[model samples]
Target chain A: MHRIVAFFLKQYPFFLFLLLEIVAISLVINHNNYHKGVLRLGVSEVSGTTYEIWSHITGYFSLHQQNRALAEENARLRSQMPDAFKASDRKVFVRDDTVYQQQFEYVSARVVKSSVNRQRNILMIDKGVNQGIAQNMGVMGSDGIVGVVQSVSANYALVLPVINVGANIFARLKSNDQKGIVSWNGASYHYAQMKGIPGHILVEQGDTIITSGQSVFFPEGLCVGFVTDYVQSPGDNFYTIRLRLGVDFNSLNHVYVIRNLMADEQHNLLKENGDAE
Target chain B: MQNSPMLHIGRFAALGFTQILVLNNVQFGGYLNPYIYILFILLLPLRTPPLVMILSGFAMGMFIDLFTGMMGLHTAATLFVAFYRKRIMKVVIGVREEDYLGTPGIRDLGPWRFFYYAGAATLTHHLLVYMLEVFTFINFWSVMLRTLANSMVSVVFIMVAMVLFERRRHG
Candidate 1:
């Protein structure tokens, strides 16, 4: 303690010098706007940067909750899209009766399990019959079509995404009215084949393909992909077109299960026609 | 030798008033204001304690800042000069034991030695004052120019004041 006291007494001048300098600097910063602005900016910048780092650190721990919230928000927004309505014209018109009827509803679900490299890729979502998720409903992501619900349990549902070999979606060219059936051939997750486009349809390399409303699973104009390449062989009846799949399967997270209100009516009509014939 | 505290206090009041009233208004060509108040720090007795010297420097600077509103620039520069005055004295007059005991004036140390000692201190004070006033090195050359021009006039005024007041001691 004695030696420590002596050491401090020897360094008293330096301590005094520092104290006086601090006083002077505070006075300068307090009185001068320019110095005050610079000091405030430096202090806030340091603190703001530290706060951002802390937020990122805490953010990693709550990723599951954040993903759930995001999925719910996406579902709410997807249900409001024009394609979710059955009306062809979007213009608002006042009528005695309701002019627009909601034809589609969406339930938010998370992909709890998935695979891409397999021939029969399947996705399991966290929502099942408890969340109104039923089999054969269309599942779409924010970017494009994902798949149809294959089966459901009490709290989980299985999905067959577009990359699966058994999956097929009726897709049409956006530029022209040419329609084709999109399917996977167990080759690559990035590419899918669109079959039955006739040869003289003037297909281009970059034509955007979207879902045709004729199918009950997916709504009209739901994006499938852009035509990366297309070729027609001699005496062939149709064009062999390859498409870059819109939804990236490797990073699939949240999906919306589209519930078509008219699906039962359409299917019953078709079944009755088949039985009569 | 130590001067009486009353005498130093009187000097402080007189010099501070004159600086705020007369010399501060004596700006020529908007660049040539003389700061003669620094002489308080320069003319302090060599035997004065370093702490007293530094505090007196700060008080005198704060007094001037109150009137001129330059806000801490004068205090910082004056404190700097006061802190380094002992080293400057040793450099001007050799490190003799008796040299530390005398007052610094043209009579105690010859005119040339005193001039050099006071001139260096005044130049340092002026450079610091102007640099702190500008607060940035973007106008470094102009700050240097102003410091040199102002220091020349201030040194001349200080020397003339010294000769006038201490002429009897010189004889």
Candidate 2:
């Protein structure tokens, strides 16, 4: 026993190195839960502020492109405005009476930080709980869905983007109501895989995919991706469909956090029914 | 001497910010991210105590992890680099312990030795990082490709940094 103690004393540094590495590895292995740890909260608060400042400086470099995209979006929105339409003739009375109400509210946020290379990529946005951003809120870019809010701080929120392996988006083919789930294969940020479409279904290249609106997180018809290719092995029941994502994750700048106004009601009703989670 | 604690702190801060602010945002072909921040561990004094080396590596990696929101990936990889740093230096430098009294810079070890050491360390660090990231052997070849690509890019950048900064023989 004394000789063993001597050996350990002589090799204490190596053992310490191993111990530290084990601690770090455990943190990585349990990273999903580590999001709620104190270290994450503290570090995010510090790093979030730093990233915000850095982004502000770098944000100037892309102003021309940003303005062009914003202008195009403004034009599209203007065309949809009621004023852009001519009034029809003869005695058409429209009754508004409780037929439609605001279902989703959008909170625009600037992406101060993001990464696309990692398997589990995350984006930090400049808005957070103070701006009504909450966990599970759907984030959308101008062109397509961006990600879902994973965690929220006072002034910043972390988004688990669609490119991340952890994110699974329920999507529907635009040509038909055929539904499938979109998931990242951790290979490339520009492409993802869609599963659950039967092999018998006719899937063509360039078929658009959009959010199904079945979940309370996102409204329906948001662009997801376009089918690029698909394959089915012999005797396989499903086709492995490839998708080219709509959002350019590398240059994501601004996004909208969607708050489902009726989320609580829907969740409560579903919980009462004991059929949906 | 260039081995002052203040210089080390400055280097750490500078590299950390550069990595978080700039390198992390720069992706080559949408996947290759050159993690040059491990240069802190690579540039540490040859005779630094193992404990100091390991802890410093952990701190540098944690600095990045904090910004990237990846709590453990960088930490584990950097710690691995730190643990094997001395051995890699020994293998590349091939000199007696008392012969070297400072950090392993291009001037101290010559360009080739420094390159070999940095390349080996970066390769090992990236191997572990990508392995833990995918956390599976299903895409083993792809992981190896990522490791090689990232390491090559990182070594090139490290060599450029050495040529630009490590000119004097202080410490």
Candidate 3:
């Protein structure tokens, strides 16, 4: 025991270095439920303001590209606005956490570091610890859902995009009441697969799919994708739904990070009722 | 007595600052994030302790990790590079195993041979890093594609920095 103690004493600095690294790593990697004190919060807010300024500057030139895309979308929306009421009477979601909502309150973010070509494409957003953006906050561009915030500093956050293999979300066809799990095939950022739709359900090519709002990350009805193509298993009844994502991730310039005021309350309530399971 | 303390600090600071300022922002696609700053590990003097090299590389990685939000990837990659610095030196130029002799500068080994030396180390470091980042997802083709692309860009910049900095020391 004395020899062991002496050995550790001799290597105290090395051990301390490793200890500090482990602490830092754990704080970064698994800090989902951990919250630092208000002291750090104040620091974060200042950094957030600075990062926002940086985002505005870095993203200024790309404004024209975003403007053009929004313009084209505006024209399409003008042509199709009236048809919304005729098809099942469009409803405005009371909650903002789901795919069901058409409009949202959010701040536009620019990606500083991004990876889309990798099997796991994680994005770094300029929105940070001070911006009131926290872990697991959902993100989307003008075209569609982008990712969930994974890590945050005073001025930025790392987000895991939907194109990654680890992604799975509750989704449904916009035209029908059918629900399914949306998962990536790890082939392309443009496409993903939806499973659990009933075999008997009439699924057609080019039908739109959206969030079901069953989870906290999304509220109810944001656009997930459209049915680009689908295939049926030889012996199974359900079709493997193929979807083309609405967001053009490769050309991403601006995005919105979503925050929910009621996520914790709702989760706790559900847990108390045993419904969260 | 000849070397100014500020000048030494300035050299490393300049390399690291330029790496983050220039190379990191220069992505042709979202595919490449060039980590040319790690040449500091490759360029430390022969007399610098192996442990110090690892610690310095680790500290540098932590600074980047704070800004980038990747906690351990850089630290792990840099430490591995630092630990293997001597072995890589031996492989490139046959070393007599007498003393754990100080490293060979470009003056001793020449730039042509040092290219193979530094190139092999840089490739190993990049491949390890790319592998660690993508191992969880485990898609063979996709990981390889990203790794190869990132490695090529990283190697070009790393080699460029090494030639500019280390070669001049011996010259």
Candidate 4:
């Protein structure tokens, strides 16, 4: 026993390091299965309070740029709605009245904390659950999809921005109508990977990537980014296409949290179908 | 033993905050951000408890994981490096720590010895982090390449920081 103690005492730092790492790995393995406890309401309340304080401080510096971006986006949306009315674009494709567009209900929030330099970056939004922002809602700015809400507090929400490792969204090519998972490659905040795209489909640079709208988060046709590069794996059935997310996470602020009015119904329906299938 | 624990904790937290706030914000060449948390393993107290050291590393990794959202990649990498830190210490420093003050650095291990120890640990940590971050889901070639290149850059920074820190502490 004395010999054992002496040996361990000599290598204690080494042993301690291993012990900590084991615990962390255990958490990572269990994280994907962490559905029950994570969905509670308190996280959102904490988020709301923090967002309010941070936004109050950074709001001044970001106001002008945010306003200009909002104005431009509004102008663009207005032009598109009128165009959709005159042309048959809106009528032909959007007959599924189930889709609700309540962009007007968006609450703008500033970003006081963000991480783009790491392989997994998260954005801290100044508005949280108290601001009517809830988890799983889509977050966007003037350009396009920024992220989805991960957790929320009364005054703050933690946004897992597109640059994060776990940031996966269902996106489709506008011209080709192919959909797949869009994930970050941990590089080029300007670009990310879109996998599971059928290799047989035609791909072009500058092809627009838009939300598939199947996630019950972002509405369909919300601009995501453009395909910058694509390659077909040998002997594989899918193409790995790279997309540039529209929102620059580096300059995130004043994002609109999209609340789908029918999300609860849609979620329940999906759950029912999932069980049945 | 008492002062060593405090020393390690304070330095760990300080390094953790810097990596999260400042280093995470600095981006250059479109896709390169040096991993600074390797410093935690690179500077563990020489004669500290192995269990405590690993726990500190895991805590640091979890601290990083909470912020960046990589699920568990940082945790995996930090754990791996912490596991190997002793081998690195033995090979680089050629001595088991006896009465070393705080963590092992140039002040404690001298310039040449500190470089070898810090370099080996930092490189191993960066390579593991990149691999785990892109593991099982992403492409292999890209992750491997990024891991190698990134490890090189971060190792350079760790070397410089050790030299500077030692000079300031001793000189």
Best by DockQ: 2
Regions of model 4 farther than 4 Å from truth: A1-19, A32-104, A117-120, A164-168, A175-187, A194-204, A229-240, A273-277, B1-10, B38-41, B49-55, B69-84, B96-103, B135-141, B167-171
Error of 2 at A181 (Å): 0.4
lDDT tens digits, residues B1-171, model 4?
534567667778778867765566567664667777778777776666666656766778777766554556688888777766777777766775452655577666777777777777876777777655544545677767776777677777777766655435534
Q: Please provide, for model 1 over B1-171, each residue's C-alpha lDDT reduced to its tens digit, 9 standing for 90 to 100.
A: 247888778778888867755676464643467889988888788888767887888888877764443457688888778878878767766545765666677877778888888888888899888776656677678778778888899999999988987635533
Query: What value of lDDT does candidate 3 attain over all alpha carbons?
Result: 0.68
**Residue range A24-74, candidate 4, lDDT tens digits:** 665555543323225323443443454445457656777797788778878
TM-score versus the correct structure, for each prediction: 0.44, 0.95, 0.72, 0.75
Q: Taking the tens digit of each residue's C-alpha lDDT, what string does model 3 give over A1-277?
A: 9999999988765675566556544443442222222222333344345445555676677788878987986787687785554555347524354856433356677776555554456676777767787887888877778877766777767677888766788889988879999988666778889999988899988998888988777767888899988888999878899999988777776788877667787789999999973
lDDT of 2 by residue, B62-128 (tens): 8788788887888999988898887776776675665358777777777888888899899999999
Worst 10 residues of 4 chain B by lDDT: B162-171
Better of 2 and 4 by TM-score: 2
lDDT of 2 by residue, A221-250 (tens): 999999999999788899899999999998
Ranking by TM-score: 2, 4, 3, 1
What is the TM-score of candidate 2? 0.95
Off by over 4 Å in 2: A1-6, A33-39, A89-97, B92-95, B169-171
Q: Give the alpha carbon lDDT tens digit for every residue of A128-240 in model 1.
A: 77788777899998778999987666666667789876688999999997998999865577899999999889988888999988788888999999999998888889998
Chain B structural similarity (TM-score) per candidate: 0.93, 0.94, 0.78, 0.83
Writing each residue's lDDT as its tens digit, candidate 3 over B1-171 gives 213335445655776656544565566555677777666666566556556766767766665544343446566666666766777877776655432343344545567665666677767777766666554455666667766778778777766666666534432
Q: RMSDs, each prediction?
A: 27.5, 2.0, 6.2, 5.6
Tell me the deviation in Å of residue B60 in model 2.
Answer: 0.8
lDDT of 1 at A35: 20
